[model samples]
Target: MILYHTEPDSPVIEISVEGKITDHDLREAIERMRGDLELNGKTRVLERIEHFTGIEPKALWTDITLGVSVARKVTRAAVVADAVWIRASMHLARFFTKAEVKAFHVNELEQARVWINT
Candidate 1:
């Protein structure tokens, strides 16, 4: 399951994912993120995903779609994940998107927030 919250006023979009991530959850997160981008226009975004246990292959595809979705709307995107693979993939894939992508551990969430906000 995924739990998401957006602070449009603060111009920050935050998303939290827990348990195993399925395709449906990924789609929902993507849709919500898109809405935030459309609402705020080129805002900074923060995604916290340390609680996420695993992901389905379809969810992996959905993640790429979501990245593209965000890139089209946001100027910067920061993701916090303890998962090594996710961190690696995001760093490598950032070059393909318009949004500058950065991944951090959960402990670095605050720093990431500050970096993106700044």
Candidate 2:
């Protein structure tokens, strides 16, 4: 499941993920961020992984495609997760994205927020 918290008139989008993520969830989130980027010109993202069990193969593909499509429009991204694999994946994803992507341990969420906002 994916939950979005977008402030009105703000260029920053916050998303929380829980359980297994489906393709539909990823697509919807991408659309939402795209809308924000269209309106704000650019966007920063803060993703909090609460309990990510895994993502479906199709969802993973969709995520990659959509993310690359909007990479240049995203200025920064901060992913907060407890899992080492998740952090590693975020690091790897940075290579494919135009955004300045960073990973933070769950305990460093506040720092992530500050970094993304800056």
RMSD of each: 2.3, 1.4
Kindly give the number of clashing pairs for every candidate: 0, 0
lDDT (C-alpha, whole model) for all candidates: 0.77, 0.88
lDDT of candidate 1 over 6-115, digit per residue (tens) = 65376777778778989998788788777776777767767788666789999888777665656666777788888878787886655656778888888897899898
Tens-digit per-residue lDDT, 6-34, candidate 2 = 99998899999999999999899888888
- What would the TM-scores of all predictions be? 0.79, 0.90
lDDT of 2: 0.88
Residue 74 displacement in candidate 2 (angstroms)? 0.7
Model 2 stretches with alpha carbons more than 4 Å out? none
Best by lDDT: 2
Poorest lDDT segment (10 consecutive residues) of candidate 2: 90-99
| TM-score top scorer | 2
TM-score (C-alpha) between model 1 and the true structure: 0.79
